[model samples]
Target: GATDADAAVAVAHPNIALVKYWGKRDEALFLPVTGSLSMTLDIYPTTTAVRLIDEPADVVVLNGRPAVGEAYTRVARFLDLVRSRAHRTEHAMVVSTNAGPTGAGLASSASGFAALATAAAAAYRLDADDRALSRLARRGSGSASRSIFGGFVVWHAGDGDGTAGDLSSYAEPIGGEALDPALVVAVVDHASKAVSSRDAMRRTVATSPFYRPWADSSEIDLVEMQKAIARQDLPAVGEIAERNALGMHASMLAARPGIRYLSPQSIAVLDAVLALRADGVAAYATIDAGPNVTVLCARADAARVTAALRAVGDFVDPRTAHLGPGATLVPGED
Candidate 1:
């Protein structure tokens, strides 16, 4: 009954974590140790299409090239999950593209897996709601769960039994619509980092002395962050985000081999953020697992924030992004 005509396409945007979760408790299930909060951005979305094929193996194309090695393997494994759920035998042809640089700490995998999970679930005729879809996306990438929702989203780190935890862990949109902030992304490096986030996280969890302390402190920060968002306090939110990110990096620095993602240029952007605050501007910076820095500020201050980042370094290419909608199926795109 299944045919190539049974195809689906979906698009999803990247998200930057304000209160980030670093390590995982269950690596196989991709369950995080702590919950994280993020804001989905309007820029650099990934669009993916899944078409069932009668062939023996799945075909994967990523950003115009034939997906190979780990990229192809990850896609096939994710589709295998869909197949198991839908009771389908057909392999799929997966095509994915990103509007921005991939694997540069810009949440490329987040958007990619979010779109893939949506498209694959539909193509396999699996009846899934948003919560179910978010869980499915988490199997591919941890941050991808947040990409399933719009605006301010939180990914809950479920506890207790494995089955119950898997069922409970998912992302939902929180109430932060009043802030309407803009995130200025400072592109300090376009190339992918030598160490993947998974590897770095594992190392930090295993060897870092500061990991436990930061995790404990981050729990308190998350509670305070939710209250700040509830009060629509932008400065409070920025302060929490900046300190949380810095604490995460400190944990990384305490690792055995010292996994450092921030560079000189990253420090320069951070300096600019501090200078903006000194001048009474509400700008705060958050760095992911790479050299790039994303500054969160009011939409009115986005231009000022972008200008400051650009002036700091010749390598920094700043782009202003705002809150974006959640993942959706886009019809009529072949």
Candidate 2:
């Protein structure tokens, strides 16, 4: 007999890149090249619901499909990490939905996995804190680790314990802290790309000659980025983030296959950011493993930045934007 508890949770989507965690040091544990920073978006996000049941099999329904086989395996691996801590006996049923369009080049997986991890912990009544939850989410996806908390978050690639090699290990937050509350605006979401994050990272690690440089240089970038956030220096933060993102993508361009996520529209977005900077506007752009670009600006300039981008003619529709809240449990619910 299992004690049934309805656990419904939602997590905002986080666009990561500041000191980008380009290559994983550990594939199994979802470790990263170095530390990374991210801001959870208020617009696109994921919501999930979980219930404890006395069922024979662990079930997960993602966006209405019976998440079986590979999907089940992926989630089960994460649940195993949860169960190792909680020792829960009852099986769970999970249903997850993403607000943004799937394959829209958004960090849907990050938000979706974070919501699932949160919902699972709630359903099992695990008393783990946010750090533990963030660790569990890392086992699912490297970026998901940052989604466990809202605002600016950094995932420090921890040292591996010889089992998964020096690079193969889990990532945790640096300095045992989170980042300041900052807003992230999606400048363009329509230009979805072909390469998935997993594939892109794999290619970059194996083929890119600049991969080593990117990883080696990230340590310095991570330190400065953290300090900038601590000081609330927008310009410093933006400069470090914009450069780090470009460094990550530059590694991709130097890959043996030499593939890039940048499209003409992406270049246009970058140009627009530079144009804004030329006009004395404090704005910058950062991209992950996709063509979509996320602009990092202060809350006050969110409107002006969106308007400027919308006027670029090739931008996506619905130019209005707002600052988002961090991930949290729904009230009187989960």
Write model 1 residue lDDT over 77-188, tens digit each, in one string.
9999999999998999999999999999999999999999999999999999999999999999999999999999999998754888899889999978999999999999
Task: Go through the candidates in order and give each one's C-alpha lDDT.
Answer: 0.93, 0.71
RMSD of 1: 1.1
What would the per-residue lDDT of candidate 2 be over residues 1-334, giving only the tens digit for each residue? 5664445565556445567878876676676767776665676778777777777877888878888776688787777767677887777777777767555556777787788788788777788677777777777777887777755667767665444432333234443123332334444555345777787898899999999998888788988988987877888988988988899889999988887888787788788889989998888888877777777777677777877777766554433333345566776675
lDDT of 1 at 43: 97
Judge candidate 1 against the unseen true structure and give its global Cα lDDT, from 0 to 1.
Answer: 0.93
The parts of candidate 1 lying over 4 Å away from their true place are none
Q: Which candidate is the best by TM-score?
A: 1
How many clashing residue pairs appear in each of the predictions shown? Answer: 0, 3
Off by over 4 Å in 2: 6-15, 54-56, 68-72, 162-184, 187-193, 318-323
Judged by whole-model lDDT over C-alpha atoms, candidate 2 comes out at 0.71
Best-matching candidate per lDDT: 1
Pick out the ten consecutive residues of candidate 2 with the lowest summed lDDT: 174-183
